[model samples]
Target: MRRYGPAVLLLLTGAAILRVALFTELYLRYVQAGLRPYLVGSGFLLVLLGVAAAAVGRREREPHGEHDGHHGPRIAWLLALPALALLLFPPPALGSYSAAREAEQRAAQGIGSFPALPAGDPQALTLAEFSSRAVYDSGRSLTGRTVRLTGFVTRDDDGTWYVTRLLVSCCAADATTSKVEIREADAPPADAWVTVTGIWHPKGRLGTDGAWPPVLDAASVRRVAQPANPYERR
Candidate 1:
């Protein structure tokens, strides 16, 4: 137990941190949507399990330099799985997963509040500039025109799938997701990086929060692998 103590602690700590970070918004949105009781209970159970493991591991110790040769490497290797999974298959952005949960937030905030800019030189465009322009421009200028975009998969309430591009100024902590709905016969799996060439059509519908919603109606959608730069423009 002692031989594997550090490894277990490391795995738990890393998992807790990663889960907390990735699901922070989900947790908050769940609470805001009045579904916290169920999620909280489940989350507490996980925490209790982690605590029990830690406690048991603390009660045993390996003699100095006398490694538990059989279990040490196995434990260490198991501890490496999470990091490897993260590298190989990073989690997708919080899109439709939280779309319903955040419907109230979206309604209260409104999409028009997003910054906008007047058309100018494209060469001087930054990500912020492009995003702001894209948000405000109503996709009208680009309507019926095929444009390329890369993002992870997200699903809406109607079971409609979307390719969501998260724009981040820094890290995933502050990422804001922008989405384009895919009109395909079969939806792709969530969290898959995809490059879509689609004609943008702006339309509004009633979201779950009973607010007016605007989204890009995609003409085409396809699946692809992750890019070298998984995170979008800073």
Candidate 2:
């Protein structure tokens, strides 16, 4: 039990990571979608390594009446922490708290010309994509289009409103916000997911993705159920 305890913990950790990454929305809060395969492979590898280690431990069991590291039960409580955390208190997706940091990073990246939006009258656009055009394209593409933007609410101190989405590069730790300032309509409570349909506000004062996030002259605000994926890729 002791000698193979770490292997068991490795198995559990891998299982927890795999299950969360594969089966639950919780994975969206921590990692990018593209990383799922690696997580699954890692879990399987851990389980296999643990099994092999346990097999070797059993084969090397010392003769009777001997107290050694092999026979002694090794309990690695520390190894169980990650699994325990994921199993107990799952993580929530990044919200307004992280919006500020993400916005700053995006603004600093220096906006460049972006590709044209797909052919559609009210094209559904992610916050990151919209912000890129808003900042870099200089309103060349979005000037007259009625676009649909979906994200959660983030209110500024002066009663301003925004519909925002966090962009994940590698993981949540490296996540950044790409939001749109809401003009002409009141928004829902902070962090409440909603889809806004409106035209882009011809550029705006910029500070951060959170502070400015470009501008959207929202014509309608409809609160919708949160989508399965919150963080938009790239």
Candidate 3:
């Protein structure tokens, strides 16, 4: 019975991760939405591993998790911490703090050759795509086109403001941000959710970072509620 305790706990923990990721918004903090299947698979695998271990241990009648006197069971118990944390508290999405800590890298690598925008008055785009266009397009595709972007607000010390979004490679731990510096608009409070419609201004460079995405000349800024999915999938 004692041998099965940890295994049961582990199985429950795995199930919890799967449930929260699937039925709730908690998964976005760690992975892109496209990874839902993989996360669920991983959670199921963990549960299976734990159940198999318990079954084998029961058949062999070996307690202490092994013949050896090592602290293997104790170490195994530590694996439950992530699940416990998830259940007790909601994981936070990457925000300005995470963005500020990382170096800025917003150069338009290949967006210069991007095909023409879809037929629309103001094309809607993810912050990453917009950043790429701003830095790489050089005013050809975006010369007069009004673009719409949605992101939380971030501020620079020099009275500059940015509309920002995080792009996650795998999780918040490895998140990179996309930002567009805004001009001629009142600086919204930090972390405010807003949609900005503006024309691209090739002249406004964001920072000392080598990847200088274009800035925006804001025509209107509309504050909105924070989105359910906070980060863009990379």
Candidate 4:
């Protein structure tokens, strides 16, 4: 058992990776969809290597073969525990805690114009797009338009709640917060997914600090299940 410790660890880790990357969509919780192929390949490679290592260990234990019967460090199994945990119970996607930790930061694009929204009664828009138009669009593209946005709930100490989503360039490690202050509606629960439909409530001058986090005068807020891909791709 001691001699096969490395092989067991590798197999457990590889199975965990395959469990998420090949068997389920759970991988999206930590990485962009584009990386799924790479993850699948890596997991397959690990499993192959693990099998090879186990075969070599078995050959070493054969009669007349040079072998050390001594046990390995007991603590070495600790390295494999995380892989087991992930295989059985993967961690949830990043949520309010991640959003709250992010400092308020927006690009210095200055005031700019936005294209007219497509004709629709209530346009579905991403939180990032809504925020950008609300904060920096000189054209005020969101004004008077009924828009629908979806995100998990997050709150401030002052009781102000937001519909927040994280935008990632590649993976959750690079995620950045994008949120909107939802007004006139009761917040569902912290980290609960919700769809907010409302008209833009403009505040402050365009392209200034005051316009950040753009407010929405919500007409209706509805609870919804979390999406498969929680993070928005940048």
Q: Indicate which candidate wins on lDDT.
A: 4
> Candidate 1 regions off by >4 Å?
1-135, 204-219
- Root-mean-square deviation of Cα positions for candidate 4 versus the true structure, in angstroms: 2.1
Sorted on lDDT, best first, the list reads 4, 2, 3, 1
Give lDDT per model, in order.
Answer: 0.49, 0.77, 0.76, 0.90
Task: Put down candidate 1 lDDT per residue, 93-178, tens digits, no spaces.
Answer: 45545433432222122234333324442222322333343444433354344455666777765888766655555454555555
Clashes of each: 0, 4, 1, 0
Residue 179 of model 3, lDDT score:
86
- Ranking the candidates on TM-score from highest down gives 4, 2, 3, 1
Tens digits of per-residue lDDT, candidate 4, 18-73, equal 99999999999999999999999989988998999899888775335643546567
What would the C-alpha RMSD of candidate 3 be, to one decimal place?
4.2
lDDT of 3 at 20: 65
Q: What residue runs in model 3 are displaced by over 4 Å at the alpha carbon?
A: 1-5, 51-82, 107-113, 204-213
TM-score of each: 0.43, 0.79, 0.76, 0.95
Task: Assess the local accuracy of residue 95 in candidate 4 as a C-alpha lDDT between 0 and 100.
Answer: 96
Query: Candidate 3, which ten residues in sequence have the lowest lDDT sum?
Result: 204-213
What residue runs in model 4 are displaced by over 4 Å at the alpha carbon? 62-71
TM-score of model 1 (CA atoms): 0.43
- Position 41, candidate 1: lDDT: 58
**RMSD of each candidate?**
11.5, 3.6, 4.2, 2.1
